[model samples]
Target: MTALFVDDRYRGAHGIGRYAREVLGRLDVPWRDLGLDGTPYAPLDAFRRVPGPGAADVVYSPGYGALLRAPRQVLTVHDLIQLQTAWPGRAKFLAYYNGPVRRVVRRAGVVLTVSETSAEAIRAWLRDDSVRVVNAGNGCSAAFTPDGPREAASDPYVLFVGNTRAHKNLDVVLRAAAVAPGIRVRTVVPAAEAAEVRRLAAARGVAERVEVTTGVDDARLAELYRGAVATVMPSLLEGFGLPALESVASGTPVIHWSGCRAVAEIVAGRGWAVSDAHDAHEWAAAMTEAARSSRTVAAPSDAYDWDRTARVVSETLSDVLG
Candidate 1:
């Protein structure tokens, strides 16, 4: 059977986009791209009205873009953070999740997730015992090796990658930086939210110590990872901690909140998972210790590899088609 993978989120720079690009690039199956355009939500709307595939064709959506009544449909639900986190868009998010997304997921032939933690969350949230939620786990890109050109920064800095969303717990990082004094925080946020992140830093009284960067390429991100003392992932929830794996892959340590079950589980015995995620003093102390330490740890068992991930996906799709 021919596999058609949806490329709805590939044009963006978010985690879902990264996952789509990397895994899709490595798949060995007879596949074609069903590309979508416009904003992130457009694909969902489009998918609902889009034509169904032939009997010999299988449709795969790598991210959350699900189809209402497609036969032989596969979906990858990265996380159920929206269902768990309290955000301004909670109402709209609930409307969509409880409406179209729920219908699509219930009809999916196979459901792929990044982590077992997320798989459980999906099962719990959907309350669907029959959904085959497979934990395919993510891998760090080969480009994120230790021996790379490091980014140049004036002082020793803690790296924080990803968007500065409320669930990211960046305020804790800023507060920790403020208390740490000597350590700097280099945050990679989206260009649009840079000003707000900077304002947050200023409000926390660590504006000078916190450097917010926007629109960095992968190579630059790898460089930043290599040069950092430790990567801070104080997120309240994570389906799979990509930054933790990438940091370990880049020969840098990771400091994450212990409450983030996926991150804590992934980084266990590889890096530090602070029990007190909300206590700035505790985070500051951990940062100080990480900065002084020169030890490099091995990548977690779940370290990202697109080829391996694609192979698993290929097998899963084959099974579904059979």
Candidate 2:
């Protein structure tokens, strides 16, 4: 049985691309890497009509950006954030993610997700009970672990990763860091967004303490996590919180803002979850506690392996084909 892991825009930079690569490495099936080679519309449009001699029996699109019209399809809904926050100018976002995209999701044979929180959000948003939930556990392979010459910095700091999307809730971290003079704040993102993030830090009165580094490679990321006091993921919403899992994989404790179901679902007792309503002092306290306990994170379990995720995809495809 052949399973097609469709990721039309397989640019190695983004998180969705990482998910596609990991799942493809795992599933024991003939796979395809139909990236942005041929496209007129968006890269997603190219995926919608991806062609080859080996037509797949089942297709899995982890990004949820592309609509698969295949006979048997599995759409992984990372989170239903489009319906939740309704951020500024959400109408445009909803036009792309809701309605038509959801119609494609309803046509899927199975709905796999990264966390139960995301699954619940999907079901509640659609008001459907039949959606099946499969938690794709998080893991960083041996390749992702720290090894080379770089080592942890001597100073205490909290790390943040991801773009400057409104939902990332970066303001909270900036606020907390401004009050905590002892700890520095570091962020990983594109250089284009650095000036704006710095403006934000300045407005919040932590401009001197906040440091933004653009273009971080995997080795630097591993080294950063290995040395950090704690990794902070304050996203107001997520389909699955990858940073939380990566922190655990890198043996750095995580401190996430509360209400992100993914963080609670995955890390449970392993890390700290703080309320969004908490003031800067409270968050600083949590950061201090996390730094003190950062060394406790262990290597994640085998279930988090990409191979295991691939095997699940292979089995699902075989069943669909049969």
Give all TM-scores, in the order shown: 0.91, 0.83
Kindly list the per-residue Cα lDDT of model 2 for residues 13-128, writing each as its tens digit: 55666776677666676656545354322535623554541454555566665444454456666677766555566775576655545666666545666666776676766655
Judging by lDDT against the true structure, name the best candidate: 1
Error of 2 at 313 (Å): 1.8
Off by over 4 Å in 2: 1-5, 35-58, 68-73, 128-133, 143-150, 290-295
lDDT of 1 by residue, 102-124 (tens): 77677764588999999888887
Candidate 1: worst 10 consecutive residues by lDDT? 43-52
- Which stretches of candidate 1 lie above 4 Å from their native place? 1-5, 42-48, 69-72, 301-303
